[model samples]
Target: MEEEVNNELPLPDIEVNSDVPRGPFALLNRYGNKLKRLSSKGGENSSKSQLLSAMTIMNMAEKVLSQSIHEKRGDVSNLVEAFGSDYADYLKRVVWLLDASEKLTKRQYDEAEELLVLALSGSLEGHPIETVLTFYGKYLQEKIEVERGRIDLERKVEHVDIEQAVMDLKVGVVECEQKLPYSQISNFTGVQTILDSVAAAERIHFIDFGPKFGSYWILVMDALARQGVKQLKISAVFSATDSVEETGNLLTSFAESMNLPFVFKILHLDTWEFKKDHLQLEAGETVAVFMKFCLMPLSDQPNGIGALLRGIKDLNPLILIVIDVEADINALDFAHRFKEALLLTCALFDSLEACLGRGNHYRKIVEKVHFQEVICNGILSEDGGFKRCFKIDLWRKYFAEFGLVEMELSQPSMHQARLMVKGSPSWSCCTLKMNGKSMIIGWNGIPIQFVSAWKFHYPVSPAIDLFILH
Candidate 1:
């Protein structure tokens, strides 16, 4: 991302995300400032770190969870005192953000109520905190007071039929096909590269984290079919043991109809875990892993995403395709979480409004089910261990920690995404954003979802090298 330093827009109080444009004069060593704020500093603090975190809510929001470290060390006073009086308000704002976040985490929206108001009016950072917060507050009120979605947020732990939830998600996804185009763009952005890399292999394999009716599987088959791959081996892994037989039948029919040597094996996970034993891989089969909106839900558990990723790393797949709805829905604060969810749902709702008009009752029904499963359940509701989704930067950090290197999502992929947006009806106003490494699907320029590809980075075995030398 380019640092378009516009020193002219003066906002003395606001701080911004590194990629977010800001009003304040560009500080000295602005590059360092960006790096410190974005990195996981792990209780380490410097003059630069203190200044940036103290001055900006985006950085400070991250550090809020670490207040215990300071408290345990009897340095809570240092938080307010260190920045000096001139910037104390900024630090105090950070405190308020932290407090509000805590209240939200405990499911106390009322206590964090003022924080949302502050988020609505305040613009102390580069991120669009105010813009998103404003929408979130309104959205939250509507969800609570009005019965728009089937998944009610007020009811804690309401029993929802698993089959009904699955069907609703399917309905929502079907409606989203022509309207949103996010999944298509994601599939278009990365699947071809994986297919191209594995096309000539005698046998091919797949381990989808959450197949959910085999959408990514369909994309893979299409790409390979175009590559004239006549035979292959395929596997899908899902934590939820739903519709395994039906999914197998669907893929088997596709492979047989295409005259390919393919087998679809389903692992109906007895436990809600990503166990290597469940993969059922055969020797010499090139494996490509698919994780699409599946890992985020598991993030609610401690070490959930990391452990599963480690399992994936152990497998040493030929390619890994990671896709998710791009939003900051995982802020540790209620107001911020709400903002992220609002931004994400706004794009979906807008796309539907533009394409699926109100007169179409079936489309509305589908949209409602989708809104509940994706928006209400996936993002807003505190039940079902729902947690917020992180942005691209955090995901990159997590991938790096797990020894995964980004596979350059091809230029043709970017062009493919761009063409999809351009080729849409002239009335549709969504845009595609490709920041070289990742692609974001946006509505009215606010990014709602992101997609990227990665491969495991294996360190060279020194023992093997020494043996070869001997």
Candidate 2:
């Protein structure tokens, strides 16, 4: 039997928006509602419709999780594997659609759609369904060829090798996370403030400092939806470059799928040039803005950071949420002599200069030699990597002058940061504990929180959030 051709909807142009909620409860409800509706009426067979379903399920399931409830802190330690179990089934469906699109006649197309609707609704599994779909697609393609009086078989491309394609798909998904993972962010100080401010804002203007596809905003969409404001719109400014596209797609799809009462516009402003978006903030428009895990890059290259801040000053967001990352020093200069600490802790580096390029981004760390050493030979210690403790005091001064009253948003101390450390990348595993109520950490024991140099991708702590929020 000949196979059929599958037609899926074209991907949409993606971008960012500012007024998204960072909470998960609301989203859970929304997903539950959608699942109910689909289970009741059966799933859709249209390529785009099925793809959307797959994405929604996958998006909701992105986190490494063991519990579904958020308040149960006891179950926090049982970490679900990075890629949970449901992923395999979802991947299979996606593969079936992609490989079997070339074998369907129109009649078979209709039948295949019905079969797909059924297949997606239940636990039935395997290549049989895929082969059937492939057969249908081939049948349609053959019929079309017959009408045109064409005879060509050798030129046909076979289905993608399932195992290899699945492997590649896993890599693609991981690569997507490599671009930015909420888990990598352990220090979450300003996230809650940003969420609260944005959720409360009557009108909001937002800026995504690095703006990788706006996943952080998706996390916050639920709050934005509940604001109940008759006139609510969020304007987001982002880097206008290819670096921002992939994440932008997820952000856009998420926003569209939720059908929130807000709109988004993604910009391509280069940090080097310090281009700012010409925003139109009206009176009574309450603006709450945040930059996700982008402080390091801006700090290392201050000229661009200065330009971005100058642009930000123009809009004057009511509350500015800055989520900073600790590693990726190429983005900035480390405080408290981190190189000395890295050299002391890591055997690979005989001296601070030698270790700067390893584990740490070699290029940027060595660009300037003003790092302070915190943990000596810590990287080589039986644990994953050395713990280089530092602070973000510089940002405090920069924003303080603007009349922003800062509050420590993190729970303060990460005592026995072992659980948290396990979640970090193998190359960058170290812990920081708070002594007293101070937000500062020591390099070999020096208080440096005032330096404003911590960094991360999302402000949400992965250990705590993975179960319910991811």
Candidate 3:
């Protein structure tokens, strides 16, 4: 499959299809009309459902146009003509990504490279979203190189080091409030459900696998703070030594501020050494295990993921909540990973335009750089622990293997999640789904991330949410 990718295939010769799309004109119009309606309509603002409709239409249009962008060819007019310069710039980048992703799947390396170059040409240097695309471009181009026999498939990022990832979790600090994951977590009903469940229990032993900055704890603490918990004890797994003290301090301060009875521990361990016993748990206590944005690192370790699951089974936590980006980044096949990476990142990048003003310099940087690093790591690099992520289905399989069954998230949880989404900016478009025992969050219809809650024994009916442990 990698061989199909032409490391240096030029853009398909511009050939105007007798049936060109007015080329992205439909989506352009849909976005503009919706924007105008939402901004112009006073008091009686457009509904979220309507906003979602616009976003879904725009996304679908892009996907359709992606497949036939080559057909639009030279006759393509200025995007600035239809939409203003701002929207035009966004469309250009979207087209470039769609073009590149579509071409990459078709193994047109040179053509994809041209689009990538075009996207990279301008002041994309400082943008996080652009940085993400850069990583995607790098990974895809590297795949072409490896297939061309220029480099080995096992190349790793030379200096893969941990940064202050948890710094953003600081309450009231709006530095990275526009982050997509925050929305996913806050809007994730499973989180609220788990917290509410534990709040009633006598004791809570919460184990986090890879606690990045203990932000999950902060979020959890925030929720607990709101409702007031009886007693809660948390065990955080801090991978970076530098973050250990800070995470502890912040969590301690947060618990005190919230006035919740909280005691916690931070376990610092590296990937190769993750052990089943490492996840400390009391034999008799209501326990919950959390792995939010942390599992991907250990995924590449041989037999490591299996051992981690086995350890989880031994603990027998009443509830296991796993939340991560919804993509099959672990797939070895280049084309499959590329498509997943492209679609997922596009959805995320598109979603952020809500809180941040369109063409907001800060947002562009966050999307280009920070999130880019994440997407690139997941989809591109074959080694150096850059293996990206997997969706909820795979996680369900793992949990099932450990004799755990999927528990339907409570309707209350779903309602909470729904409220959170409704509470966000009216201009933002996020869709939530609850089918059987699964909870998913998506940008438009494309599932960007998902959350799954599981347990040893699930009641046959979804109505049986509350029960005694014994």
Count of residue pairs whose backbone atoms collide, per candidate: 10, 67, 20
lDDT of 1 by residue, 164-238 (tens): 556546655454453445655666556655665575676677776654545446556655565565456666666
How far is 285's C-alpha from truth in model 2 (Å)?
2.7
Please give the lDDT score at residue 236 for candidate 2.
44
For model 2, residues 1-470, the per-residue Cα lDDT tens digits are: 11122111111231222222234222222332332332232111111112212223222322322132343322322322223454445433423332222112223444444434432544423222232223333433443443344645334423333223323343333332221212222223343345444455555555555433345456556556565543444554554434345455666576667666555555655544544345555677666655644444344343445555555655556656555433311211222132323222222111221112123332222211112122211111112223322234445444443344454333211211222222322212122333222233212222222212121222221122111210
Model 3 per-residue lDDT tens digits across residues 231-305: 677876666665666666778898998887888776677544555577555555788877666566666554566
Error of 2 at 270 (Å): 1.9
| lDDT of candidates 1 onward, in order | 0.53, 0.35, 0.54
Output candidate 1 Cα RMSD: 15.3
Lowest summed lDDT over 10 consecutive residues: which window, candidate 2? 461-470
**What is the Cα-based TM-score of model 3?**
0.67
Model 1 ranges off by over 4 Å? 1-163, 168-175, 215-219, 222-230, 240-244, 270-272, 373-386, 459-470
Candidate 2's clash total is 67
Determine which window of 10 residues in candidate 1 has minimal summed lDDT. Answer: 461-470
Query: Top model by TM-score, which number?
Result: 3
Q: Stretches of candidate 2 above 4 Å error?
A: 1-190, 211-213, 229-236, 240-246, 272-277, 300-302, 327-338, 341-390, 398-404, 410-470
